[model samples]
Target: MKVDVQLLKDICEAPGAPGFENPVRKLIIEQIKDHVDEYSIDNMGNLIAIKKGTKNPDGKKVMVAAHMDEIGFLVSHIDDKGFIRFQTLGGFDPKTLTAQRVIIHGKEDVIGVMGSKPIHVMKPEERNKPSKIDEYFIDCGMSKEELEKKIEIGDPITRERELIEMGECVNCKSIDNRVSVYILIEALKNIKSPAFDFYGVFTVQEEVGIRGANVSAHSINPDFGIALDTTIAYDLPGAQAHEQVTALGAGTAVKIMDAMTICDSRMVKFLKKTADSHQIKWQPEILAAGGTDTSGVQRMGKNGSIAGAISIPTRHLHQVIEMAHKDDIVGSIELLIAALEEIDTASWEY
Candidate 1:
């Protein structure tokens, strides 16, 4: 099946910054409710959808996690002149915020721009330094009285960028994890006759930490776990060969390890074998820094789980113009479905 770019666009465009994941959570529920046997939102705002396994007599569960949240900001204060001070909800490169547009989700959605000092007035020494996060503020372009009517402190703010098709990829804000969200939804709908029951969890607070995945995985305690997320594709120019984590159009990533967790070896081998048997293109991922929901899924269970991850190779990650290849996106979905169907065939003994 081909990629559904429209559905992916809708998923990426929906704002759900860290703890403020209500909007995108709702969108995921709408798309998957009818496809799953059952689905529910947890107390911590994770959306869990379950599909019963047709072939399992052992009552095994496979938990697949895809975080629903994105890196964003929260209003901290509104200045007397209508400039707004904010705190970021997740990691951000300060320079990427320069003059970027954002949406403030308060009493109503209000648009603002990241305001910073113009280089024309900067001291010669200042112009050479990288921008600092604290040096920026939001410009609402409205009077303080008018701004107060629609915005206030603690309201969530999100990057403003629409998904667009590049030559061979999709570019948009929140592609870091939103592309994984799209993959999980498609896999849930497409997988038939899985080897074990599947718990498709669209998690929250992952951009902050794996908080939502930790809670949900603790509750599910599955026999197998796979975290679907994006990893850096430093395949761009001016990079050494060893430094490229993965590349656009390279294929779906089979996680070896990241800073937070070393993936279960058995699960890693199973993913690779399954992909080869199915002839799905694949790559190995070793993120030197950063992590995904894999950490929580691997250790939060009662006995811990045989966990790994399927990472989509993405460039300009955590930035507004994050990008991923459509081919890699489709490869991820294929590999996930193949794994669920063939899990019973793999040797799980370590």
Candidate 2:
């Protein structure tokens, strides 16, 4: 099955930093509203979509979560020279911040360039060390008075980059989670009669923590949950063999364990079995660090629901030029659709 490249590009390009996901949420709702039976946004801004099963409306409830937020920054202080100092909202490699273009969401969308001192004038010790994030500032080419009039503290800041095709892979900012959101929407459009009542949740504030998933899972209390997100693929030139958590073009990753949760054994087996039956490529993911919405859903509800994840293998995760293979994206959608169709609570093992 061919993935929708256009939709993927749209989601990746949209701005939806943590705690500020209205732009991406609106786009998702517009695409999925016609396909679902009912949909609404939660108090925490999670877009909850319900697609009823043809067999039973009260059938097993299955929740599929894909966060809409991305790593970004917030304006903390604007100095006299119109240089903006920002507080990082999510984890960032200080190395990636220097010389990058950003969009500041203030009174109006303003373009700014991240700047730092030239290495030519740096001390020997300073040149050998990585630059601190605080040492950098954003230059909007405006005076202090002009900048203060259009911008204010607490405005969101995001890396500015459009999606680009790189051979078989695509590169852009926000691909970490937006790719999974694209997968979920595509699966919902293609799947026919599912065995369970499906809830496609576009969660918010996942970049900061799994806050949105935590709340939605508690309210839905799904029988089974699958969190869709991206896992870091260290298949690079310098990384060692054992350090490679996943590889680019390796297909969808079926989560075994991460820092957050150990996948339910039954869910793992089911996903592998489904992939084999459909001839969809897959891999086992054992992430050393990092967490996803899966942890939140697995521990939610009265008895806790069986939970797992289908992750897209991404290279240079959280960077402005994040990359994901197109084939792996399609594989994730195929595996998810197949698993949803076969979600039979009676047949699932304890």
Candidate 3:
């Protein structure tokens, strides 16, 4: 069965920066309420939804996590000319910050553009140097008095990009994780077989430091854990084959290691076997730079638990135009469902 592209689009386009995930949290709750057997929110805003197993209560508990927050900006100070100075909530490449449109969430929605000194007006020395984020400001086209009337010091700003389909792929902001969240939801909808009790967690504040996952893991203490997220695909120009990470259209990525955690080898092998037996497409991934919720869940319990990651290969992550193939997204959903269907306490070594 095909994944719902429109639903993925909706989730990616929603605004939910770290520490400000209420809107996206509500959207996810609305979508999964009818399908999940049980659901609730923890103190840290992690949304945990469960589908009970058909087997006896002795079955193992499996936790699947996907972060719901996106990289965005927080308003720092509004200058006299109504230009807004901001701080980034997550990692950002300063090279991508010029002339981009952003939505400043205030008393009312206000649209703005990132303003910088034009090349013609800059000194020759500045032309060769990359611009720092602090060097740019947002222009809302309002007077200083008018700006203070609506926006404040802590308002959030998100990239303004509508979801768009390009060939067989989809592109938009926040697909880095929102797409993975959609995959988890879709898999829950498609699974019909008996398996271990499953808890799908939509975690918050991951971009800030995996804060929600740390708390949620301690609460659940599952026997097995899997983090569904996106991995960078450097298959573009100037990228070498070894450094490509994972390629687009190469199927869902089964991560071996990232900066945060090294996946349990046994769990990795089990997932790979399950995918192969079920005819699900997959690729091996090793991310050199970043981490995910996997780290927190892996080391949370007494002696900890087995952990792994399933990733969608994405290009231009944390940007307004992140891209992922539809086929890879579908493959990830299928593989996740297959793994959950066959999960058992005996399969876990620890």
lDDT of 1: 0.94
Q: Candidate 2, which segments miss by more than 4 Å at Cα?
A: 56-58
TM-score of model number 3: 0.97
Each prediction's TM-score versus the true structure: 0.99, 0.97, 0.97
Q: Could you give candidate 2's per-residue lDDT for residues 1-350 as a string of tens digits?
A: 77678889999999999999999999998999898889999898999998887655666788999999999999999999999999987788889878899999988999999999999999998899988888999999999999888889999999999998999998999998999999999987889977789999999998888999999999899889999999999999999989988998988999999999999999999999999998999989999899999998898766688999999999988776799999999999999998988877335756
TM-score of 1: 0.99
Candidate 1 lDDT, 1-350, residue by residue in tens: 78899999999999999999999988898899889999988999999999999889999999999999999999999989999999999999998889999999989899999989999999999999988999999998998999999998999999999999999899999998999999999999999888899999999999898999999999999999999999999998899989999998989999999999999999999999999998999999999999999999999989799999999999999776899999999999999999999899988886
Candidate 1 residue-wise lDDT at 247: 90
Summarize candidate 3's per-residue lDDT along 186-293 as a digit string, tens digits: 877778864878889999999989898888999999888999999999999999899999999999999999998999998899888888888888889999989999
Q: How good is model 2 by TM-score? A: 0.97
Residue 305 accuracy (lDDT) in model 2: 88
Q: Please give the distance, in angstroms, between residue 302's alpha carbon in candidate 2 and its true position after superposition.
A: 2.9
lDDT of 1 at 131: 84
**Per-model root-mean-square deviation over C-alphas:** 0.6, 1.2, 1.3
| Candidate 3 collision pairs | none
For the record, the alpha-carbon RMSD of candidate 1 to the native fold, in angstroms, is 0.6
